[model samples]
Target: MSSPPAHPALSCAGLAFAWPDGTPVLDGLNLAVGPGRTGLVGRNGSGKSTLLKLLAGELAPTAGTVRAAGGVGHLPQDAALDTRLRVDEALGVAGTRAALHAIESGDVREEHFAAVGDDWDVEERARATLDRLGLDRIGLDRTTGEVSGGECVLLRLAALLLARPAVLLLDEPTNNLDRHARRRLYAAVDAWPGVLVVASHDRELLERVDRVAELRGGELTWYGGPYSAYEEAVAAEQEAAERTVRAAGSDVRRQRRELAEAQARLAKRRRYGEKQAANKVVPPIVAGGLKRAAQVSAGRHRAVHAERLDRARERLEEAVEAVRDDDAIRVELPHTAVPPGRDVLLLRDLELRHGARIDGEFEVRGPERIALVGRNGSGKSTLLRTIAGEVEPRAGEAAARVPLRFLPQRLDVLDDGLTVVENVARFAPGATPNRVRARLARFLFRGAEADRPAGTLSGGERFRATLAALLLAEPAPQLLMLDEPTNNLDAASVRSLVQALEGYEGALLVAGHDVPFLEAIGITRTLDMDALTSPRGAT
Candidate 1:
């Protein structure tokens, strides 16, 4: 493999940032990024996006400095263009295109030639870039609002590629992309030769990076190679950390034992001296000297053991911190179980919005785990909402036979103004606050985290809170339908979702493009929405 560049393309020193409310997000953060792709990952709310913003000069640090080799290009988290602008304008080639067209005509203006400047093939390059990013079908004259959100992201990146920025910062670039768009972005990352830093949760995207930069507790930790390599290294480190903790724990216990034994021995010596003096074995002066010497020795001995025990405890604390196993979600929903031969869902001749139709009857029986897979704008979310009774089908009927809950792609299942506990309680009216908190704790939202307003939560935290509310509902969701469940979730939250599903014995219908995540959750059947909605489609 080629080594990283010798000189830094982007670097920051003693970087710090804080919210207006005085809550510090990042402090004394230092990073030096050279050539090649780097994937920045961490649990949600680790300030990865904030770091990218600082690097791109979108946000000024409360302290410290940022330096770069040349002009930096940044793709914002919510990248978009004015709906009225043409595709060429969004790609940053409108002016050049106009100039070239003017020169092509009989005008032959000097200013037009100057505007074109050596970039005579600008239109060709722009079209090529758009095609490379899976925008081949989207013509240059198309309006910005005509494309999907995912395509808009690609368009922004295409513009950057055409601009030829010295450094690029992509924040969750794949969050809005579909599988096809994501594949194109992966190819773009592979072809990029300059400094590229991407903050992403997509496993496939992280696997393409040359290095992994993890932001945890405001510190940057670097790992060589791809996502798998980083996981291996972390696993090995955690094993070593646990071993160190075990050894330190044993040492602390041993020190305590030894200290107790020494105290016992000192007490025995004092008792023997007193007994001898009482029995007149030594004169008064000799007895007094013996007692003073024993007192001094016992004091020193106990102090030594006490100090050793303190040191051992401190080591144990340090070792525990080194281990990286954060708290995981381990909720078991026995109440959500559906026995075999149960009819969980039924959809007969359903015609959803956007002219999508399921012409035949469809049924989900027992504890089936079905995956709804499709491209962007393929009506996956619409189908899920139809089944949940949130949206009316244009024709026919959709019904859920069992008690069910739907987790929409937006994760808008909770009341934003309410605390997490209160939201869960909203779904379970009879449950007490303590009972709600007890259930939330299983989803890793314990103590103050459970009391925090849902609006204040990170994306991952919001998912957890929504999940807690769903699974802990009164009748228990026997059929759970989730739409694009893994979007914008960190790796830890994904794992937590997997864990939650592992213990849930219910019918599940999850619509998403994350195939690996579907596999992880043990998807037993796959249904393609495109095939389901075609003219010859069936149940």
Candidate 2:
């Protein structure tokens, strides 16, 4: 495709990039954006983050040019803020506000006037940005350490918004955010006036984008109007592609049948010609001429049918190529099944070590899916840890009636030196190697991937590996719990996780703020950490 005319916002041309290890992340990618929000989406390791970094000039591309009309503000996935820094300093306005304050006081100086700049409204804008991001309560004088992790993310975004750059890039902006904070981020996205691109697996945030740019196989595909529309379009395209594949297969079969019939007819003709010549019903020369002409005609007939068959086969191949193979795993977890009347878990008067306390009785019976939701500091992970026997509750009892497993968000269960297969085997000692490998394959770990050491796995890969190991554990984990499961996952990984959970008959207690994910995995009920427990929020 030809490049578009110059844009005032952000654009890239003939972009190519590779990692330090010579692993090609992107090649010949071209993109153009002007004054509208774009959601950049892809599976983990598909270079969505790499592309954003390249566009922001944080990483130089191997091949092409990136153009920004003005400055670019980037909020990286792990954009770290100093814990000791004040909110105004984090927002990059402390000096200016200080100078403004100096001028207002008795000690006015020329440097103060210079530092104030022409815009005296900086303080007002900074406060408004914070207010917009639902951080007004945090106070500008407060240190970053005083805020929760989710609030810190919003503060970073607030800083970016305060800068008022011409282009903004957000990578996983909603990673650890709760439902309220996510909505606040969504509002910020909605009100952004400049060119914006967000790389995140958060469906709700992606739903607010004006367009979606999907990076797959080292190329960018533009889909107009948000993630849901893109998904619908892809679904329709896959359906049409499958229909074409079926039609093409039928055509190939029909062409093969016709070619066989033609060859059979030619054989009969040859036999008839030979028999007639032997019987001497006609002159020898005429008989030979008849045979030659019949042979020539038969060769032409065969050629026509053969060509048709070839064309049909080519069409079939093309149709098959068009259809996507988004195959997810399917494995029956019968060993993990809990009978309808079985008691899975029970917690009474739970008081966690971090000053969080849970009152009243809580229980899980049979195979129930429960969603855990709350602000970042809410003790959801602590509750799960107590239930998993990793931590003792300060007050009451947390016990499981069945064999259980807990997969934490940090994913520290695997032994780094062991391969994925080895780790799973360690858990399921009774299972044969072949059975373990077969089950691992269903989790999308196959061949060399299953053989790779757990230490080298990416966040999403490690999550899958840990989940697989836990599921294949001894006694098969009739009760499974996960803390903030969607924090570091990409879209495909999230889908794979959801699908993997679909076949399990075990009781699930998943802690996270991804409402759509909870809904997708068929949650039987929701447990709000704020309502279920009380803790001194993150300092």
TM-score of each model, in listed order: 0.84, 0.80
Report lDDT per candidate.
0.84, 0.82
> Model 1: runs farther than 4 Å from truth?
1-6, 76-86, 94-120, 143-149, 176-180, 331-355, 363-367, 385-404, 410-439, 447-457, 469-479, 502-506, 532-539
> Model 2, clash count?
0
Each candidate structure's count of clashing pairs: 0, 0
The worst-scoring run of ten residues by lDDT in candidate 1 lies at 530-539
- lDDT tens readout by residue for model 1, 68-177: 99989999765767879899999889998999999888679899999899999998999899889878888999998666556778999999999999999998888657
* Candidate maximizing lDDT: 1
